[model samples]
Target: MKITLIIPTYNAGSLWPNVLDAIKQQTIYPDKLIVIDSGSKDETVPLASDLKNISIFNIDSKDFNHGGTRNLAVAKTLDADVIIFLTQDAILADSDAIKNLVYYFSDPLIAAVCGRQLPHKDAN
Candidate 1:
């Protein structure tokens, strides 16, 4: 099944690179990766652009609404069989995270799935 992954970013901070790296290292990468970024003064847009196969769409910071931004991203991925949404700061815990999650879709009745989150290893 074709999978599309969308991440909404706004000044994602220093951890952005790590988040992208973790995604790139996934055992099963998304067929399409899209980043919807509101006006960010930082390097969020540049960093996302440097990655191949990532499509970036910009919106005014004032127009950014959590739900609306996500809906916008979804609009661009109509052809995908599965769409996965992740926040800019979310770091996948392991290479198999996406692979494991997609495996659940094999069940015909599973319409949606949510993954668990754990604190970072160094969280205080």
Candidate 2:
């Protein structure tokens, strides 16, 4: 099954590096990675370009909305069998996260699945 992982960002400078790293470490790598940046003024574009298996899109609009960027990213990959939406600030707890996500599709009836999110200790 082909899966597309979409990550939407806005001025996500240093945070994107970790997200891409986490994707690389996944036991089951996605078929494609789509990153949509909503007019970032930082180094996010260059950093995204350096990552393997990633397709980056830089939207020029001055108004930034996470949901809109996410929709655009999803539209770019409508052909994929499964879509995985991830935030740039998230880091998978395990390399098997993607593998586990894919396992749900084996049942055939399962249409979608979601992962859990936890606050970083440093956020406190």
Clash counts for all predictions: 0, 0
CA deviation > 4 Å runs, candidate 2: 61-63
TM-score to native of every candidate shown = 0.94, 0.88
Query: What tens digits encode model 2's per-residue C-alpha lDDT throughout 30-116?
Result: 889888887778877788787667898878767558777777788888889999988778888789999988899888899989988
Q: Residue 121 lDDT in model 1?
A: 65
lDDT of 1 at 28: 91
Candidate 1, which segments miss by more than 4 Å at Cα?
121-124
Estimate, for each residue in 18-102, the C-alpha lDDT of model 1 and write its tens digit.
Answer: 9899998998989889999999889999988877578999999999999999999999989988888988888998999899889
lDDT of each: 0.90, 0.82
Clashing pairs in 2: none
